[model samples]
Target: MDLDEAFELVGEFGPRQKRLTAFLVLLQVFVAFQSMLIVLVGAVPEYHLDLEEIPASREVLAKHVRFASNFTSIATEWYLIKHDAYKVSLAASLYFAGLLIGNIMFGPLSDKLGRKPVYLTGIFFDVIFGYVSAFAPNYEIFAISRFFVGITNGGMSLVSFVLTQEYVGKSFWALTGSLTNLTFAVGIAIYALLGYYIREWRFLAFISNSPGLFFFLLSFMLPESPRWLYSQGRTAEAENVLQYIALGNGKERLSVKLKQCIGAVKKDDSESGVLSLVKHPVLRWRTVILMYIWSGRRKSTTAFLIFAGIACIFTMCLPENRGGFFFSPSILALCGKLTVSAAFNIIYIYTSELYPTVVRNAGLGVCSMTCRFGGILAPFVPSLKTLGPSVPFVVFGISGLSAGFLTLLLPETLNKPIAETIEDLQTSTYQMLKNKKVNQLEENS
Candidate 1:
């Protein structure tokens, strides 16, 4: 029997199964560390350096502190070095561009290579670039590092969704997917609480990066996805790996099923590539919509977030213009950051389950790209502060909500076997929608 047949024959087991399952959960820590590192890129150490001890007014102090928290800020400082607003906007734009380039490449890679290897490689790049960013002697190098970091780190983010979904039993897919992104929310919450105590920018950079070393070690302990191995026609190795997984999970060895699965494996499958994706109508449509959604979501979130942060900064920087009770702009920025972080995690779970496995990576990639692109547009909301804060929020909120509505177009894949190809996807959907009405009529008898 195949693995599916074997699952049916053996049926589900009990508490001992839970003990074995613990090992799977343990693997997520490495992915989670990567998530935490990517988010910390925004609020770096230089942000707090000069201002923390300044005796001058907020505006004067901000200038002393290098008030340029992003790449735009860096650029402005480089040229119009004294113009804080221009610099802030410029820095935000640069970060968005980084995400755009990174996201464009991350999907194809995960699709071509198995999720595990690509994920580890991405993390390695992130740690290396992140350290380089810390020592960047100038704004241009810093921007270059940030852009590369975004690309590498962007790939790292996708693996959590892919790996967790690939390895676990179908029943646990939603929960694992949700928690994988939820790591960001948790990271943001921790960052918020810690931000007050840790004001030095460089020290913060050091602390943020320290987790990556642990990931470098933890990657060794993670098993490559058996699903990927099987797909690649490495059945013997896949089976051995699966046996260990079963053993680790306290289940009986499934040798016969492994043999059956291996026998079923055939070569000459469709390779994942840009051309391959574009050639198929279903994948083509899925890719376009997903990319639109991904780009829109990223732009929307980033635009609103930077808008809010800049507004708060302006408030703190100007006394005559300062309105209301005073909380430092940094603290306010933390609030916005944490809010976006929570929203991102919640949205990803919903998006991840929205496609069949045949196109899961493709679909998720499109959606993720949408989110990142929305963030890219986020930094450019100049009129929002000049016009009103509510303006940007409303615009972004509407854009995100619109993406949520588009989500309804997708079917939920929870508890379903992962589809293997476009044909599998079509047949599965046909049965779900087509057979349902027929079954209902027959049931009336």
Candidate 2:
């Protein structure tokens, strides 16, 4: 019996699983907070430069005052006063760049070192850097600190999601994974509320960073993925974790059954890396498709939103600014957000199901890295405004639509057992193709 079979005997969504899943999902709140904090922290506030002190020609004074009034950004608190608003974009891009780097480094590290350690280390550093960002004396320092924060944020978010999925049975994969993202949405709302009340960015930063402390404390209670332990030939530890899980579900007697299953299960000690995704013929195509879909999803979502924002620019006559949330533009924007968010949730769950345990995190990391690349480039998409207002949207829309079409090529994993090894994946692919060929032959006959 495999780990998934054993999980069924114990209880898939038992009390223990719920507890662990909740704790891990809650960690996403801080990830959201740190990620979206830039929306407010990088905001360029409207301000005026005092022209009374400096003597200048009337025309020169007018020009200086006009430029000063337009020159605004949180980074301007330190420097870049003479620079264009791209400084803010650069700072934001650096944070996403850090996320890209973290995903590259920590995804495989979790597979090698274990999920618990990587997650704990990520949260610890996330907290440290969060505080550093709050107290940064200069814009350069703040940007650097935020970059580190992004690195930790990327690792923590990836590990936590993978860790959560690892604990549950395949039947609950979609439910649990999608539900986990809801916290991130809630965190965004909470940040908005905080922004409304707290005028100071530093104070808001401090409050946002405070949640990582709580998460770090709660993380101690999380156990290593039992499936991972079993894969590593650490049957004794795996048994202990399963026993704890069974006990939590009030099925302590199943411990013996779990032990028997664990004994029969073979361990996969093979090492895998990013390249492993493409090493096998079957997995290689799947990996490529997954990467493209990831990139397309991000590009589509970001570009569409930017397009919607441009639409809002022309429709400023709407009452949304007056107080109503049901304006046409607002509703359209919300719908787009909802659609993209649901797509994100589905893709995350889908990617988790597609990869084997040996390289699951790595696969996720690479896919997420591609998604981050989209994010890194998303900021620049708006610059296409120089071409035309609809031009960026057209580009994003085409990418998104193409991605949507290509998704039909992916094999359905609904109610399917998680693939535990590359051999399992290859065998399944072979059998599926053979069956398809047989069906076609029968039709021809």
Candidate 3:
């Protein structure tokens, strides 16, 4: 009984698998809170950059307050870093920068060392960074803390999702694949709900980061992956984990299934790394297309579209003196925000399906890295207030349009079994071509 066979024998997703997967999925919600907390923590209220330049008179301050009304964000409680729009955007971007770095480092590490250690290390960092950012006394300190949060969140999101999906049987692959998106939605919703009431950025950070402690404490309840252990040639440990699973699942064929899975394990000697993503014929193109379409990448059309759309709305909301609609611009902005969220959710599921299991974490890591870079660029987009409206739109619009066309090049894996090895990826194409040849011969006969 090979590992694939053992998986099939388990008879679809059972209660034990369901319980374990549910815990794994919760990791995403926590990740979302840490990463997306910037939406609240970085919210800069109305601020006057020229305050010191102007007089200290009440009339002068009042006049500048009216002048500052041109900006977006609240004036509630900005760290000293809040004086400039570009600076504020950069402060928000530091978290994403951390995310990119984290993904790059941890993806390969998990592939080398197994997922649990890498994942727990990330969660531990996520909590520490979250609190550090909350209590950071200065802007530079806050940004540094956010960078670590990004690192941990990026590592956790990529490796954890790949790990969870690896344990899930194929019967529920597509269904389970979308669970991260659901949890992310829940996390973002909670962030918005808290932001509405808390209003203070640091307080929001405190509440959000506190959950990581619970996750870290509960981490012991979960076991290291049996599949990962088997892949690394730790057959004894793998069997022990499998036996433990069997007890909860009430399946009697644990020994038989364990032997089958272990006997079939094959070790690959190739020294492939991130560069290997683009080295294989099929994987190279697959990696390219996935990066192009990944919703998080800076080149993503959704960001440009949303940016352009929001810029257009802000134009309409501009006063008649500024030559605009002057009516409330709330609904259109809300819809645009929702559209961006939906596109990202779709990308998360799509990227996971496209890559084979061996390189799944690495592939996601690269995509995640690009996405963070895009996020880094996103802050500057709002600072383009000096460039006039059409400039930002044109820049983002072209990227978005190009991404849409690029998405059409990738293979659809809606019903396909996920490839577990480079051989699987390479051969699937050959099998298709062989079938085509057979059909042509049959027509002649």
Candidate 4:
């Protein structure tokens, strides 16, 4: 019997899995905090020039004026400069860039080193860098610190998510994944509330980064993914972990069944990597489609709607500028957010299910990397109003619709055993293609 069969014996979504899922899901809150922290810290607060401080000389015409405000941020702490727009944008962009880099580096590392260690290392450094960012003396240092924080965020987020999926049975995949994302949404809300009350950016940063320390301590309880262990031919260790889980679930007798099943398990010693994903016909198209869906559907739709909504409401919805209640851009924007948020939850679970175990993290990393491009580009989307008010929304809407239609090409993974090897994935894909062709032949006849 294989890992899936062993899971059947041990019990899926048992008390042990529930406890583990809760811990893992809680970690997502901190990730969300780090991901959205820049919105507050790098915010440009309202300020007016102190005309008295300005030198009235022809040679000093280009000099920046002294500005004063009650609000404290990277923007206001340092006087706004001529290139303030580019500098602020860079600070935000660098974090996403770090996220991109982190996904590229850590995804493969987790596949090679195992999930728990990579995740822990990520959390440790994330806390370290979070503190560094909070205390950064200059805007340059703060921006650089945020970049490293983004790197750690990418690693922790990806590994923790993959670890969550691996711990549960196929039946709980969607439910647990969606639950974790709900926590992320909650985190974003909490961050907004915190930002509202905490006027100083440094204080807010300190408070936001403080949770990582607690999460780091809690992470000690996380176990290595048994599925990953089994795929790597560490059957003895995997069985030991499963036995522990079995005991937790009060199915101690199932440990004996796992012992028997382990003897029959054949180890596949083939090496797998990111490149392997595209080397096969079955995996190549699937990878392409999944990447496109992640980049366009998951990232673009969500980012565009959220940013566009904020832009319209703030810029166009003054009391004098308000439109009809039902047909208002604000109402339409909220609906768009609701639609995309649901899609975000589903795509994460779906992507995790599509890839096989060996290259799962690597494949996810690449897809996640693509998704960051949308994030990196999202802020500038609001600036596209110079072209047209509806341009950004239309672009995102079309991309989302196209990706929604393409999802039909993906095989349904619900209630199916997770693929443990590339061979297993290929065999399943072959069977699916064969069935499709046969059905088409019958129709032609």
TM-score of each: 0.67, 0.80, 0.74, 0.83
The C-alpha stretches of model 3 lying farther than 4 A from their native spots are 46-87, 199-201, 233-239, 256-270, 295-343, 378-405, 429-445
Worst 10 residues of 3 by lDDT: 67-76
The parts of candidate 4 lying over 4 Å away from their true place are 52-69, 256-271, 297-332, 380-389, 429-445
lDDT of each: 0.54, 0.74, 0.65, 0.77
Q: Write the residue-wise lDDT of candidate 1 on 14-124 in tens digits.
A: 332343234334434433433443343343323443434544354454455554344332332333233333543444455556555665676656655666777778778
Give the Å shift of residue 12 in candidate 1: 8.5
Using TM-score as the measure, the top candidate is 4
Q: Identify the superior model by TM-score, candidate 1 or candidate 3.
A: 3
Predicted model with the maximum lDDT: 4
Ranking by TM-score: 4, 2, 3, 1
Stronger candidate by lDDT (2 vs 4):
4
Candidate 4 lDDT over residue span 25-64, tens digit each: 9878888889998888777755555454655552353344
Q: What is the number of backbone collisions in each predicted candidate, taken in the order shown?
A: 30, 0, 11, 0
The C-alpha local distance difference test score for the whole of candidate 1 amounts to 0.54
- Model 2 C-alpha lDDT per residue in residues 102-147, reported as the tens digit of each score: 9988888887778899989999999999999898877778889889
Worst lDDT window (10 residues) for model 1? Answer: 72-81
